[model samples]
Target chain A: MSFIEKLKNAWVSNNSLLCIGLDPDTEKFPDLFKTMAKPEAVFAFNKAIIDATHDLVCAYKPQIAYFSAEAAETSLEQTIAYIKTQYPHIPVILDAKRGDIGSTAQKYAAEAFERYQADAVTVNPYLGLDSITPFTAYRERGTILLCRTSNSGAADLQDLSVDGIPLYQKVAITARDHWNSHNNCLLVVGATWPEQMAAIRQLVGDMPFLVPGVGAQGGDVNAMVKAGKTADGNGLIISSSRAVLYASNGDDFAQAARAVALSLRQQINVARA
Target chain B: MSFIEKLKNAWVSNNSLLCIGLDPDTEKFPDLFKTMAKPEAVFAFNKAIIDATHDLVCAYKPQIAYFSAEAAETSLEQTIAYIKTQYPHIPVILDAKRGDIGSTAQKYAAEAFERYQADAVTVNPYLGLDSITPFTAYRERGTILLCRTSNSGAADLQDLSVDGIPLYQKVAITARDHWNSHNNCLLVVGATWPEQMAAIRQLVGDMPFLVPGVGAQGGDVNAMVKAGKTADGNGLIISSSRAVLYASNGDDFAQAARAVALSLRQQINVARA
Candidate 1:
């Protein structure tokens, strides 16, 4: 199935928009996993979190840096496989944010899909069409482009006025008009900026948005749901990484993560209603 | 020492501007290392190429996607260590093109510097200063920004006129004024578009340009040398990946790569003089 269909189906079936980010920092791991190697410990913690909270999220976004920096490809590979086999319905979005020339980009696509088998991947749009065309060629996969990012420096270039509108809006227009031939293209509009999210949602009506910044980033959950949702009230994937994954550093960590995920999902549904 | 200093000192000592890219693809590997595992074979191939051509280049840029995609972190780690231990002076630019939030960006910097030990790393400026600040904070390292990339789709968002100035030029202005506090900043301008290369060169005066698109991408080498050269006549890192790495499909691949590197460097010197 195409990524959008998988996303929408999973969204309705789970009744949740929460996307817990599985970004593990070795330095921050609890004392229990120090017995094993760093990468293995990271994967073990992720597995525990997934087993506890898989039912509460439409997707899981794993920032590749956490694994790549440590040469933890085994853990990354195992994590994606485990998700696919165990939670079959939930999509795994590999947040690599890759952008390169055409030939090199083809290799990146192969890496994300063929090696890791992620259902979706996040990419940077700075290099333009050809850089993204390779990723979009994977018709069954979702290519989420960065629009208004959930960072303080996003204002650096994304807000620059191009023509009468801002660059992020231009990115939205381009995605809407030119890209998305296979109906698998999506966008990342940060939850930190609800007013801007409303403008973006209005621009790309009914399209799904992978919204970060709802939990640890301190973005208001209600404001995000109100402004970021599509017409059918089900077009948002709210992601929370640090706030959920590191909710509790002790043995109750998994339970604490589940509680946070459940709370975020329930609040999102209430706002949707 | 700072990356720029290393890059300049190496360029002057070698009297060359060529930067060989060590982006290995297993399927494209010569028949010799095919017996080993993919990662090992890729590393062997890179080691051979580096051994043959280490003296004729200013920098060695290994696009991290190829290695990361293959889970060949061993090869990547070994390659960087080999260059530092063997060549010592010539810097390695880990062309990851990474861009993200502040916290995540910090992890990526660790991956590039701490894990891979790359003296310089490429970054995407799309997320603006905040995403780049962490990487630049490694004042001892080089933080090369993507201004006008060596890709066709670079025109997608980069060429859009932002208040009479194209987005790429605006990027040039920002990199010049805001981003380069430690004198370790550089820009990647495609060798394909000599006119744009010239335009970008004028804006960022004397700042080195990591020029890709010279060989297999069909960009003119002489034109790139003339337009991309800094005022000191030695600031262009002319990169050619596929052209040099896959120069031959036989055991003579290393010799052929050395030949290509030598020719490119001589051609660049002629253009500079």
Candidate 2:
């Protein structure tokens, strides 16, 4: 099934738009995990969180840096495999943000889809169409492009005006008009910028957005949903990483994570109405 | 020692600006490597290339995609360890091109410097300074920022005019004035666009450029050197991967690679003079 279909199915089945970001920082782990190796601790924590909150999330987003930082790619592989096998309806988005020249990009595409088996992958659009095409060529998988990022410095380049339009809008237009030939393209319009998200929504027309920055980053959940939601109120995959993952640093961590995920999902559904 | 000092030392010791990119594609491996596992094959090939041409180049760059795609991170780790161990003077630049929000960027920084032990790492500038600060925080390690990439579609966003100056020039200006406080910052100015390279050189005076696209991507050596060379003729690290790597798909592959590296180094020197 195509990534969009998987997303839609997941959204309907789970009645949630919350994408739990599995960014395991071992330093932030609970006391019980202090003795285990970093990778094992990450995997154990993620499994518990998944088992507790699978039905409350539409997708699972795993940031590659956390695993790779500790040389924990094996745990990452196992994490995705477990998600795919146990929560088969939920799509897995690999937040890699990879961008390179054509030949190198093809290898990254293979890395994201073939090696990691992610249903969708986030990529940087700095290298333009040829770099994006390699990922989009996997017509069934989703290729999420960065438009207006959530960071304070995103304005350093993204907000630069080209002619009369801003650069991020240009990125949005290009991704919408040119790069989405396979209908597998999406944009990362950070919830931190609600107004920009609205503008991007207008430019892309129902192309689902992977909206990050809503939790620990302090992006307003209601404002983002109101600004970025499509007619069906299901166009945004609002992601929360640290806020939910580290809700409690004790043995109740999984329960705390599930509680946060449930509250976010409910808040989102309320905003949808 | 700082990465810039390491780079300069290697440049003087080797009397060359050429950097060999160890992007090991198993499909392109010579017949002798076909029977081995992908990771082993990649490590063996990279070891041969490093052994053959270590004396002929300023630095060695191992593109992470080639290893990560095949779940060969072990080989990549081993390759960098081997370079640092056997050839202590030569700097290893990890061409990762990573960029993200501040929190996640920290993890990526750790991945590159701590896990892989890369002397320097390439990063994307689209996310701005805060995203870059985590990498630059390692005041001793080099943080190479992407300015004008060598890809055909680089102009898509890079050429956009911001207040009459191009975006790439703005990037060059930012990297020079703001990001170089520790003197560990470098710019990636592609050899393909010599005019742009010259312009960037004018913007960021004498800041060393990690120049890619010389051999395999059809960038002219003399044109790039003329455009990008500093007053000392030593501000560029010109990289070539495929041309020197797969120079001959036979048992004499290592010999062929060394020959190509020698020739390219000679050409760059002639251009420098």
Candidate 3:
């Protein structure tokens, strides 16, 4: 199935817009799991989290650097495969902001899809079209472009005016008119900057956004929904990484994580209501 | 023992400014090497290139994508170790344009320095200070920041105006005034835009620039030397990847690569004269 179809399926069937970011730090892993092998521990923690809240989330977003940093690559692969087996319909977005020239980009696309089996991947727009075309060519896979990110420095270049328009607006327009021919394109607008997210949504027109920066980042879910939602009120994948994943560092971390996920999802629904 | 000191030592000792980019594509490898095992083949290919051109070059830049694309991860580690042991003084700038939030950036820094043992690693400054501070904290390692890239679509964002200044110019200024506190930071100024390269050189004074886009990208090498050089005429690492590495697809590809690197070096020196 196409990534968009799977995403929509997860959204409607699960009745959710929350994407749990699995950004693991070994330093923060619970004592019981930390005693296992590095890869084993990561997979265990991820499996426990997936088991608890797979039903409540539209998707799971894992940041690849966490695995690469720890050399838990095999565990990341296992984590993705486990999710596919346990919850077959829920998509996984690899939050790897990869950007390179054409050939190298092809390699990274392969790494994200073939090695880790991520349904969607995030890419940086720094190098422009040629850097992105390889990933966008994967008709079945989703290409989520980083537009206005959650961080303050996102304004460093992303908000700079290009011919009287900010660079992110141009990116949204480009994705809408040029790159979305396969309809495999999406945008990542930070929940921290809901106004920019709303403006970008207007420009891109109903293209699904994978919004990060809420909860731990102090972004209000209410503002995000009011500003970023399409007319249907369900066009955003609101992501909360640390607040959900590390809700409690004890043995009941999985249960605590589920509690956080459920609350965030409920909060998003409340805002929609 | 700092990146600049080692880079300067290589520059003077080698009497060359060329940094050969080791971006080996397996499909493009010679039939002879193709018969070897994947990891063995990659290591052999890299060793051959390094051995042949070590004397003619200032540094070796290995783009991590090539190894990751082929799953030749072990070979990449071995390749870096081999360079450090065989050519002890030449720096290896691992061209991984990594960017993420702070804690994640620390992991990437670990991946580049502790895992691979690269003398320097290229980082994308999109996420700003928090993403970069961990990298800059490694005072002995070179933190090469992407300023004005060589690709045509670089104008998409890097060329956009922030107030009255272009974003890239602002980046150059940021690197100059704020980020280079450790005196280990460098900027990536492409040979494709010698005019912008020149303007950046004036802004940055004598800070070393790790330049690409010299050969396969149709960038003028002579113009780059004339425009990008500091007053000392030794403040650049002009890199050429495919043009040198894949000069011949036959069995003599290694020798052919050496010939190209030598000619490129001589041409750069002539321009310097």
Q: Which is the leading candidate under DockQ?
A: 2
Ten-residue region with minimum lDDT total, candidate 3 chain B: B152-161
**Winning candidate number (TM-score):** 2
Candidate 2 lDDT tens digits, B32-98: 9999988899999999999999999999999999999999999999999999999999999999999
Off by over 4 Å in 3: none
Error at A178, model 2, angstroms: 1.3
How would the docking of model 1 be graded? Answer: high
lDDT of 3 by residue, B136-244 (tens): 8888999999999898767766887777887899889988987888898999988898899999999999989999888998889889899988888889999999999
Please count the clashing residue pairs in each candidate, in the order shown: 0, 0, 0
**TM-score of candidate 1 to 2 decimals:** 0.98
What is each candidate's DockQ, to 2 decimals? 0.85, 0.87, 0.61
Q: Please give, for residues A1-273, the per-residue lDDT of candidate 1 as tens digits.
A: 878888888898898888999998877776787789987898998999999998899999999988877778899999999999999899999999999988888889988999999999999999988898999999999999999998988998999999899999999989988777777789999988899999998898887898988788999999889998877889998999999988888888899989999999999999999
The TM-score values for the models, in the order shown, are 0.98, 0.99, 0.97
Q: Which is superior by DockQ, 2 or 3? A: 2
CA RMSD, predictions in order: 1.1, 0.9, 1.6
Which regions in candidate 1 have their CA more than 4 angstroms from the true location? none
lDDT of 3 by residue, A128-234 (tens): 77788888888999999888888766766677677788878988997788767888999999898778888998898889999989889889899899898888878
